[model samples]
Structures are given as C-alpha cells and as structure tokens.
Target: MAFAANTALISSPTLFTPSKFSSSRLYLSVPYKTTKFQLYCKPSSSLPLTSLFCLRKKEKSVLSALSDDFPAVLDEIEGNSGWDVAVEGEEGEGGFVVQPPEEAKVYVGNLPFDVDNGRLGQLFGQAGVVELAEVIYDRITGRSRGFGFVTMATVEEAEKAVELFSRYDMDGRFLTVNIAAPRGSQPERAPREPGHRIYVGNLAWSVDTGRLEELFSEHGAIVSVRVVSDRETGRSRGFGFVEMSTESEMNDAISSLDGEILDGRPIKVNAALERQTRGRF
Candidate 1:
C-alpha cells in the first residue's frame, strides 16, 4: 500500500509482505482499475510513498483533501484508550470541587499555609488544567495545615505536574507532588508515644465505650475509651477514641485492624493526637 507523508495505510494480511531490503520498509502490490503496481520503501520515512504509487497530481489533490479528517480519526484513536483531548479553557462547567475523573492524577503533601484555590490552580495549571485544589483545615482553628491536594484535568497533565512540581519550592518550603495513591493505600502508621489517643471510626450502631474497650483491650491495657456521640440526640455518631497503655500496643492494634471491614463497613483506625481545646465552649 502507498501512503503520503502524513498518510497511514492499512493492508490486508495477504497483501502485505515484509521488505527484504530494509527492516523499516515494506513491499505491497495493489490492483487498481485493472492495473497492478509494486510499491517499495519505508512508508514512515520522510519521503512520501507517492513516488512509488504512481499517483498523479490530480489524485494527490484528493488525498490532500482527505488529510483534513486525520485529526478526527486520531481523536477517535485517543478516545478508545481512556484519554480525552481537550482544548484550553473549554473544559465544562463547575470548578475544582468536581471529583477528578478516574484517569485524572492527584498531588499531595506540604503546601504553603496561605495557598488558596487560585494560587494552586495557577501553580499546577502551568503543567496542565487544574481541576481542583483543597487545603485540609483544623476543625477548631480552621487554619491550614500546610498540606493540600491538586487534581489535574488529565492523566498526562497529572503526571507532568508531579514531575515538574514534586520538589518545587514555594514560600521557602519544598512541595511533594506525585500520582496520589488510591485512598487507604498508605501504610499503617506507627503507633504514637504512650498516652496518645487512637481515633476510631465506622463503629457499629450498638458500639459504645464499653464495647470499644472490650474490642481493643485484647491488644493491651486500655486506659480509656470514649465513643463520641451527638450531644442532643445521644446517638452514636460512629466514631470514638481509645488510649492504650503503651504505644507498642497501639501500633499492634492499628496494624492488625486499621482498615479491617467489620459489620459490613470498613473502619478507620489511626493514632489520634491530643485535641487542642481553645477556650471552653
């Protein structure tokens, strides 16, 4: 089959033969309008295969007209593999809050304390469109913890952002960006020093301080267990805290059951830091 500079050719299995002349070249004999012609040379090379195909000037014009549709064909090829090619500023409505598509990449780690959505968008948008930026905050003080997420619009952009900004510095601190691992993929955290409380979530509706103590007491002596509940309703909110006698025991407990699904729901178990109480409520 003959092809132009930007043209691609598809050949039937029997009609295509590997070239004995060069590894990158192929030979094809095509029958068109009662005449047969032999084609040779590399279709991928800079020279167009027209030199061998005997296409007249008029026929070349038709081929040129067909070339206009190549991008759309290529777009279809890209679409089949979980990629969507989009032009700049044309992404649909809704800002960063939208969940990044499964193919989208995310970044994590320390960020500037004052960083906002716009700044984050500008920083990551350089690599690719930034779909979202969020800074986790302390519940009480509402202060940024110098960490946040930046979700890129596409996998390629996400990968590019990670490569370009993983160690880029802002406000005198180095940033950490990478393909965000799926949630709960992080390794179990080592237990904190003694006296640290463990945050427990996804408790069964019937769970309470006594049940929590009973469950966690197997690992070590339980200092205390408190199931946080709604102040007005007195119903369990499905979270609690447990203080172990030693950090080693806490480590064992967390390692054994941090994400263990119990009673149809996966539990979130982690070392809980001391709660900062800023003035009594």
Candidate 2:
C-alpha cells in the first residue's frame, strides 16, 4: 500500500526515524511544520536499502562538515536495530567542561630540576596526606620545569604543608611552597615597563643579591637585583638581572657600568631583553 505524504501526523510531534520502524522500506508521511528532520527510505533489491535524510528548514545545500568518507558511512548503515547517538569529544562525552577542585592544592616552586612526581608526592607527604603530585614538563624538551603542584587530602593539610615547607631547604635550594592559584584566575602578565631593567653578565660565583645591589646602588635607585643560580648547586650562575627605578637611571647604569669591575671580573651590562618562551596554547 502506498502512503501519501502528510497522511501521518504524529500527535506528539515526535520525530519519525527509521529506527522507530522495523520494516526494510518505509512509505513514511511527515509534515514540514512538525519535524526538524525528514526521513525517506528507498528499498533496493540488493542486500542493503538506501536512506536519504534532510533537514526541513535548513538552507544549506550540503552537509558542510562531513568527512570525505561520510558517504561510505551512509552506505554501511543498513537496517540498524537502534538509534546511534553522536558525541563531540574524543572521550565520547559531549564536550563537557570540568570544574576546578577545592583549594587544597599547593604550588611548589624552586624544585630541583631532577625532581619527579613520585619524589614530589613523598616530599609533600611530610606535612599531611597527599592526593596527587605532578611536575610540569616542557612540551618539546620533556625536561622538568623545576616547579610542580601538589594536592593535599584536606585544606588543613594544605595549610600545614605551606607553613612547614615554605623556604624549607630541599636539595640545597629553598622551596617556595604556597596555595596554588586556580587556573585562569589571573590575567595574562603585562609586558615589562621599558628601560627600567638591565642584564648583567660575567658575574662572579661569589656575588650574591646583596653584593650586586651594593655595586649598582651607586648608579641609580635600585628596584631589585637577582643573581641567577643553578638549580642543582644553589650557586651563582655568573649572570644576573637588575631593575632600576627609571629609564634614565637604567641608561646611566648601562653606559657607565658596562665595563666596571665587580668581584675582580669586568661585568657586561645591557638592556634586559624580554625572555623568550614557548607559548602555552
């Protein structure tokens, strides 16, 4: 029997899908006013029947995002016994966003370059129970970034760890342990103000922050000074950075102190370059 179009008006306005019908071929009748999709099945004398699907009001002349082999998929779907649901994400979830956990995690900095996740968990376990510990690694080089985060079992435990480990020496380097900031809570760091900083090289291993400050304080109002140290030995790395109060002070220091001797070594001074980074995506 041939069923005319618009002959069947589903009272609930429920969708008419081939999965709802058991027959190999269907002369389904649907109205444009009701369904978002229209389905028409073509019966073939071959093993599998062909089906055509179309959206009712969509003006697109094509399926814009279909893969090259999507047509092969339609050919493969024969008389399916059930409806197939599609999900967006790779894990089969519908692109769900996960919320950050409670404030029981601590950021651990000044870590040794060789520290591993297991070591971090063990170290943080000294204060209280540790749920997880992971060392961040460089994406390309796969080296530890000398910093990691640790999740405590309770907020009180996290607080205890912060109190006990902040500035606590680990492998000759003092640690900077504190509550981890929630991701995305901070704005992107602004660029450094122009001409307020200078890079000093050819530093002596004996030179510390205090010594460097004493040396440069004569040139300008010193904002801060730091002597970079090796993560392993906690000794000066023969270079440092200094920030002055103003552009004029920075220029005066760079011009007058470039070849000045400090700690028996002639230091090289120049405007500090912005640090290069592999951007996080």
Q: Which candidate comes out best when scored by lDDT?
A: 2
The residue ranges of model 1 lying beyond 4 angstroms of the native Cα positions read 1-99, 184-281
Q: Rate residue 115 of model 1 by lDDT.
A: 80
- Per-residue lDDT of 1-281 in model 1, one digit per residue for the tens? 54445433333323333445343332334322121222222323343223232211122222222234445543543444333222211134332234667546565565655787678878888897877877776565465655778777778888888888876767534676767666767755445444657899988888766677667877876655667778676678999887766789899889887987766778899998665455673
Task: Give me the displacement of residue 6 in model 1, in angstroms.
Answer: 39
* Residue pairs with backbone overlap in model 2: none
TM-score of 2: 0.37
* Candidate 2 residue-wise lDDT at 192: 50
* Candidate 2 lDDT by residue in tens digits, 235-258: 678999987767898999999999
* Per-residue lDDT value at 103 in model 1: 49
lDDT of each: 0.61, 0.67
Q: Native-vs-model 1 lDDT?
A: 0.61
Error of 1 at 13 (Å): 52
